[model samples]
Target: MEKLKPKLFSVMESYNGQQFIKDVTAGIIVAIIALPLSIALAIASGVSPERGLYTAIIAGFLVSFFGGSRVQIGGPTAAFVVIVYGIIQTHGFDGLVIATIMAGIILIAMGFLRFGSLIKFIPYTITTGFTGGIAVGIVAGQIKEFLGLDMGAVPSGFIEKIKIYSESLHTIDLSALLIGAISLGILIFWPKITDKIPGSLIAIIVSVLLVKSLNLQIDTIGSVYGEISASLPSFHIPEADFKTILQLIQPAFTIAILAGIESLLSCVVSDGMIGGKHRSNMELIGQGIGNVFSGLFGGIPATGAIARTAANVKNGGRTPIAGIIHAITLLLILLVLMPLAALIPLSVLAAVLMMVAYNMSGWRQFVELLKTSPKSDIIVLVATFLLTVFFDLVIAIEVGVVLSSFLFMKRMSEVTEVNGWKYVEDLTDEDYINDIENIKYKKVPQNAMVYEISGPMFFAAAHKFIDITVEGKVKKNVLIIRMRSVPSMDVTALRSIQKIHKTCKKQGITLLFAHVQNQPMSVMKKAGFDQLIGLNNFLPHTDDALARAEQLKCS
Candidate 1:
């Protein structure tokens, strides 16, 4: 009875009487910021403006209520713009809805599997490359929208997307271009004046007023999509079949990857801000639920927004109440004030998203990395970037993982090598080591000593050992191999060692292991190397092996 009480108690605990006003204020402020961008991102994504709001209201609320991170804010964001737009254009919204639902199922399963920590395994280079690629694709997509050109149902492929734009360059509408450029300019520089109100929101109001008052000849949302439904979301289960299911898989994967990266990255950024930890698996579960509901409500996909989450933490939102309030504020706006949103200009929304692309890009960091990082890493960076730009996000990710893995193996192989030597601690005593009169090993004949090793012998340094054991390179005899350096062995290194041992045997020299570790001893013992070599040979030290060599030579 009491256990059920705590679960209920936690939900009530999230609401604070004192902080509610502050949360409302922050929510309203953020809503103002989210409005223009949401509508623009929707339109740019080949959906209507209402869908974006539906995502913000429904998905945003669910994530805040159930998510592990207190400060995370959820909404339709710029990150999903390219992928969603492509999916809708190709497979239609029904396919997208199926994909979103499938992705939600995958995410939910992943959460239960506790696979959240695995998201960290994705390399930083790959993220940077694909993110940069997405940004480029987004910018290219908007050239048609921003310039108000006739794209004739816009191509889904990247090269085709570009070709469509280039061919229609002569059809640019000057009124729309002026609106877009001016809105972009205001958004870019408005932070210098004041941030109490978002520049995009203010630009939207100003542009709408200008267009309405001056009777500008540019396009408007009402002109294109009639009027948006400023209402709360209702449940929607899209029709699914074999064809829809098959088509949905690719987009579903893209959504899952995007959701995973975006959420984890946001959690990481918030951790830095609050000096706190979040349960990744719990957060993933929450995101799964959020996205599931997001699709059910006819909303675009949503994830943790780092900037808004940071803003929440920075402003005194220590609980999930702020996120909940954000949703409520949008809901209130939808119910009572949605009709007012039509006054916001479409060009202003594009400007806001353009700013989003700019902020997310980190071009300076990209260029700096290219200049400083190794050629191999740079190759991955450039390939992912180009593929993301010229091909598809899914393809870029696939090839990037393969390339990164192969390069990582090659780098590890380059440094892995083995060498045999008569180790002396003191180099200054080289006179005694080199001098014919005092050299310790001078009396040692060839084919007497053996040194063996057993451990995690891997590709990180396996090649040099092969080069060193070439014909005519022998300097000593009966080399007692000290097998203590090894704990485990891979097939490649084992093959190299076996080849060396075979050569020594062919040359009529005895090579033996001394003080082998139990594990490697058992491994070699089982492999019959211990039997083929004659069991009386292995010695404890180089000195004993030298003595054995001397005795055998004389006898």
Candidate 2:
């Protein structure tokens, strides 16, 4: 079980001025990188640009203050864009607020219940598939903004969005295209010039200047969303009914699951960079607190941003202080300079998001998995990806998890086996007691036989156990069973063993066991199978069982 203690408390005892300076510098730099990204992700999520800043300021502050990771930067992330858009479109902004709040409660409960370690059970193929799908969805959503197409509301469906974009191609504004191209060029090449300032900030400044000087007829944030709010976010409760809460359960769960996965992943990555361990459950609680407040203050869902967290590490951030400073810096910018954000062209932001989407895509890993992974993994990957792209994320994740579980069970069943022993000269199969154990050299009475069971004995493999152990037609005075390789047993497999004991009794054959491991032994003892078979029948080794069998034959 993980202790719900924040990293801040642990690091502060040894904190010094030198490290504080580094933290301050790192935090400010991360804030600069997060500014445009927060805004872009918010607009992409179908909300006003200022809501992004609100998330950065509010959620960002709370997560850092209470989070488990030393330098994790929390804010609006690209992963939530598609889901946020869909939720808002289907249920409206108020409904989204309610759903986000519900998600916060779910996360909080998960943290307290110690479910942090279980997040790893979600298959890697599913995560990769959905992440790539999200990247594609982001690109699709940005198409209109990137091309400056004259169009109304874009469809949420991927195929419909593509069809709509194609029909609207003729309406592309060349000036907006030029801005997007120039912004992308700056982003690609500006880091070579200097790494002190973020390329995104530079791109936004240049794009704003270009629009102002050339009087380009492009859609700026102000033109689209009106004057950006410089005032602080106001608190308001989202109204909901019993029916609405029930209806929003799936989406809320989706948000909670994604937030948990991404935040923990960020913690793992940052732990490697800083050589520090993070309390995963604590991080979940921090995220829950951040999100709950973020919704109350009119912001979208937020989580630990991997890119910003990495940037914090690279720039000398070593404590939660850095993350705290980053949030404060964003707040200052929101109060002092938020109005200027409206002057930036929407096309430039689109290009920034396109870069984000490309990074999120992970195409290299996807291709490698496709080429080298097993056929079952390939099916999960493809199924999750297609579902996310064509359908919705809720469906993609639900189906992917269920599919992976079934495939895992199938693989487990394949490895389980029950085999009768053979003489060394007959064949040296590993499954049978052979020359490896030198058991074949032992003299076996004509009235006795032996069998070995391997792998986990679960419900899926119970039938195989019955077919080989109980259904055998051979009648013998004594029977010996080996189970050294079996690590565990379930109720179903225990029942099969019971069947074998009953059958052996009815046939007037003595049933004996050898090399039973702890788990299976416990199950048998708990179920009173030991008493049923008689305590003396359970032998420590095959040699003992064989000796006992000889005595039984003589009797």
Model 2, 284-339: lDDT tens per residue? 99999999999999999999999999999999999999999999999999999999
Score each candidate by Cα lDDT.
Answer: 0.74, 0.91
- Among these predictions, the greatest TM-score belongs to 2
Tell me the tens digit of each residue's lDDT in model 1 across 274-335: 78766677777778888888888898888888767776776676666778788888888778
TM-score of each: 0.84, 0.95
Instruction: State, as a TM-score between 0 and 1, how close model 1 is to the true structure.
Output: 0.84
Q: Which segments of candidate 1 are over 4 A away from where they belong?
A: 1-24, 423-456, 459-491, 494-555
True-structure lDDT of candidate 1: 0.74
